[model samples]
Target chain A: MKYLLLALLPVVTQASEITTQRQEELIYLLHQDCGSCHGMTLKGGLGPALLPDILQNKPVEFLTATILFGRSGTPMPPWSFMLTESEAEWLAVYLKNPKHDEK
Target chain B: MLSLSLFAVEPRGTGDMGIVIERANGSILIIETTHNSQLYRVEGLGDLSHASAVFSRDERYAYVFGRDGGLSKIDILAGTLVKRVIQAGNSIGGAISQDGKIVAVSNYEPGGVKLFDSANLELLADVPAQYADNKQSKTVGLVDLPNQHFIYSLFEGNQIWLLDAHNPKQPVIRKFTDIGLQPYDAMVSNNGRFYIAGLFGEEGLALLDLWQLDKGVQQILPEYGKDDPKKPVYKMPHLEGWALTDDYALFPAVGHNEVLVADRHTWNLVKKIPVHGQPVFVIARPDGHQVWVNFAMPNNDTIQIIDTLNLTVIATKKPGKGVLHMEFTPRGEAVWLSVRDEDKIQIYGTEDGQLRAELPALKPSGIFFTARAHQSGL
Candidate 1:
């Protein structure tokens, strides 16, 4: 039980590092800024879809790395200048399991 | 004593009417320029995330091209959806032919241009973007030429094809391959002669003279920004946003914070005007007195106006965040701007640079007017 609690501590700590307002802003950036290429609904456009089903096979670490350092040959630009490593990881997790549809 | 009739039709002209895509909701606001008010809210358009519109010749109807391949013809006078058809799996935009008898859509998914009978939205012909191994490439930079001719660029195929669709069933396509690395978008000159495509993977633009098709695609300003460091483009520059004057042409330099000005006749690089961030849209006014420019992310809120006579950015205005698009009025008296984050369509005087009016909108991206019906390559 102690190991289980220890294993979950990092995930909670990473997510809690982002404030509520910053989380909302990140979500807006996901739907608007990232949506410019990936479609506002994340169905797909120039870039591929980001829907859970489409991204189910892609590992979260791969997506987070791609988010931080874009693919070299494609039009997907790097977001490292704007996003931190942990923030990108949080976004990657959020993309895999979106919670904004709760409204 | 006056006799009133319930079936009497109101006398009106559609030149003052237009449609604004409510992008998030898949709805449109039927608006008029005179009153600046929405007449009706038409709904059920599929995936208007990157929607565009083209007006019929009569200006009574608008054919809306949605990102999800939904082609809808709306009656501006009646304020209702006349007809709609999912022509492809995914589409970027569309164009209306010179004769107004046909409508051509540029698709991204199935990778081709599909023509439809403008009267009733019936599929007429399909020109596939075929290349190596019968692989498909997304079509872009679609523009209609003067005599039922259409031109488009293939992004992945690295080619441009001109389709002569005089006959709805049959088309004579002229393919110009090896044009550039990645031709993202293209535009035809106002006089209907030159077709220029902006390359996404290179430093210059691809040019083709319609009058002299035998020469093939010519590279212009092949090294405009060769020495500069390429910045990551948040949004690709719209070639349709280029402005051509009598003696010069001003367009955005891809991945660079500059607007390249070239001689109109010689196509030689005249000067590189340093600007704020990367310009996404560098459009000219109707009279060619001034040019207005808007940039990509981080600097998207600012608009810079240039003096065409002096070739300098005379003024700059920050009209709130997310300045997605700008459209000049018919006579160039005023320009309408879509502020996405602010949820407002702000109007500004072209000459004075003053806030003329403001209209409420829900994340408006493109603000197209009916006046585009008569313009070439709008």
Candidate 2:
């Protein structure tokens, strides 16, 4: 029983470490790329405000699509080429639950 | 005798100068045309924002055109916003009638001119402009003409439209063909005889004979070297400079960087005097012998002084970046220049070209000064 518990603890630690790394990467990307139009905090700039709680109920898939395809008839231009599909998906997840696992 | 007083904002690095004359009884209105807008009131000048700032013949009210298409009327003596008129299209350019009864604004999206009753900010009429091509139009420049008429310049269409506001409900539109590649601005001489328009694609001025619109509009001679076509064309005529005098008409040319002296009677480009880079706007001193040219500099900021008598540049003073527009006090004691990129208004001595004061971080696009006589209810 003791040996089995030790093995499980190592596996749990590794998963948490990976999750932390991904969160850091997502925040860095948003600050660098989106800060110009959207405020660094994503409050608002030339673009509309995008607070975490306000967007929490929004579908992650829809958020990814908007980021990749962009809103037509507005100043938002498409960023499909700039971001990979997986990266866009991660951003969507982060935006939808911005306060998740707060550091 | 002319004197200069400088009003410098404490911290220097802010850009652009946005200033307005107050309509309230005892204060002046000044705003910084920056991303972060700041508002100021002149102690004795009255509340500028409350005044309907139309330069009408009567000079009683201020006509305020908001960016969101809100027009307001302010009573000068009462220092209060008197009325709010019907909303119009987005206004980037505006002008008041010579008689001061009408206000005209150049709308952006709908791409036309909207005339408003100056006293009430009431919608007089909407005159749709005709474009040579099916292009989205941005009305960039407007000038008031004599006889209840006004001229508007379009950004996309690159044309000029003359609107007759004689009947506010039905405005007659007269299009001047082949005025220039892109007509950015138009100015009618005080006498109402000659109208000069500026081109963004050409190197010279477009001279229109108001008396004879049927005759071909005259393309005033250009002063650029044939090889340099890419140098941005003169964006506005009389941009080089214009002084209100009964006898002679003076204009500045950006391409040649010189003031073009024209015979008011004959409407001929009699001579040209060389000036500095991109002379944005000019103000004639009350003496009428010297017209101040705000020279827009790429590397440095400076104002070029021109001797109206000889049509030559006499001196240059460094004011700061992006000296795009200027206003002379009605008394001609000081000249207020909008240093756009720097976001400040630099006040200068009209006689010696000295920096008297600087108002930093104003995103000012236009500047105007009310004549003292007009203020005195003359």
Candidate 3:
């Protein structure tokens, strides 16, 4: 039980670390910065779409790694400098959800 | 008398009028420079996500190119959408001909350049960006030449094609192959003599002399910033905003925090001005006395002004976040900047660096003026 609690402790802390304000900033970055290459509506442009339907095949971990490390040959640059590992993970999860409106 | 005067039309000229793109929404704000105020918020332009505008010779009609391949003809005088057509699946931008008769759009999905009658938005010609194995390359950097000629670069095919639409329906094409890898965007010089394409996959720029087509395309600054370690580019630098003076031409160095200044005649690297961030738009004021530059991504909140005579950064100003674009008035007296994140348009005096006015907007991206009607590669 103590080991399980320790394991859950890290997860709880990690999830709580992303404040509501930081979440808003991340969403803004997703829509504006990432939206620059990927279409503002996430439909697709120079970069591929980040929509839930299109990104369903990509796992959360895979998308998180791509967000942090970036695709090497492509124009997508790494965001590890600005984004934390968990923040990128959160963005990947948010992108995979189908709640975003086209607008 | 009041009822009679209400129906009477106020005579006005469209030379002072311009369009500001509300990129998030498919709408445009019809604005006038004389008053620096919004005249109308014209909506229903589809998917203006990455839109650009080209004005007709009369400065009355604006040909708006949208990301969803929407070609909208806006009547600025009446503040209405005159006509619209889905010309392609996905499009980047467009250009108007020297005679202002032809309007050509560059596409990405089923990549090609479509020529239209600027008068009624009628299709005149279709030129595909076909390369090896019948694979269509994404066409970009479409700009007008002096004689109904349109030049554009291919991304996947790595080539630049010059289209002579003098005979609209059956246009003549001159292909320049193996120019470089991934010619992302291009621009014609202010005088329309030189067309330079910024290569995304490499460190050089491909230059074509419009007068000497026989000379072919030349690679300039192939080894610039070669010594510096490659930094990740947050946003692609727009060559459309490249600055050119009588003595020099200024371009944003990709993946580096520097702006490359080259001799206009020699095309040789003259100096590299280290800037605040990865430079996006390095634009010069109309008078050519000072150059204004904005950055991409995290450093986007700041704008740096460079003195053309000294080649030194004269001043740096923080004009709020998401400073997507800047446009100077016809004679360069004042410059207008679009602060996208703050949802406002900030106008500053070019000489004083003082805030002149502020107007409300919704996620503005590009601020274009009617003055571009007279310029070649706006």
- TM, every model: 0.95, 0.61, 0.94
Off by over 4 Å in 1: A1-10, B1-9
Q: Residue by residue across B255-308, what tens digits does model 2's lDDT show?
A: 446556666666666766666765556667867777777653342367777776
Per-prediction DockQ scores?
Answer: 0.55, 0.04, 0.53
Question: Per-residue alpha-carbon lDDT of model 3 for A1-103, expressed as tens digits?
Answer: 4234423432445646788688778888887779887877777777877888989899888998999999986888999999999998878877876353223
Candidate 1: the clashing residue pairs are none
Estimate the lDDT of model 2.
0.57
On lDDT, the leading prediction is: 3
DockQ of 3: 0.53
lDDT of 1 by residue, B2-109 (tens): 335535767789888788887878888888888677888889998888788999999999999998889999998888899999998788899999989999999988
Recovered native contacts in candidate 1, as a fraction?
0.30
Off by over 4 Å in 2: A1-103, B1-53, B66-68, B76-79, B83-89, B132-136, B154-159, B222-229, B232-272, B297-300, B339-345, B354-365, B372-378
Interface RMSD of each: 1.0, 12.9, 1.1
The order of the candidates by lDDT, greatest first, is: 3, 1, 2
Best by DockQ: 1
List per-prediction Cα lDDT, in the order shown: 0.87, 0.57, 0.89
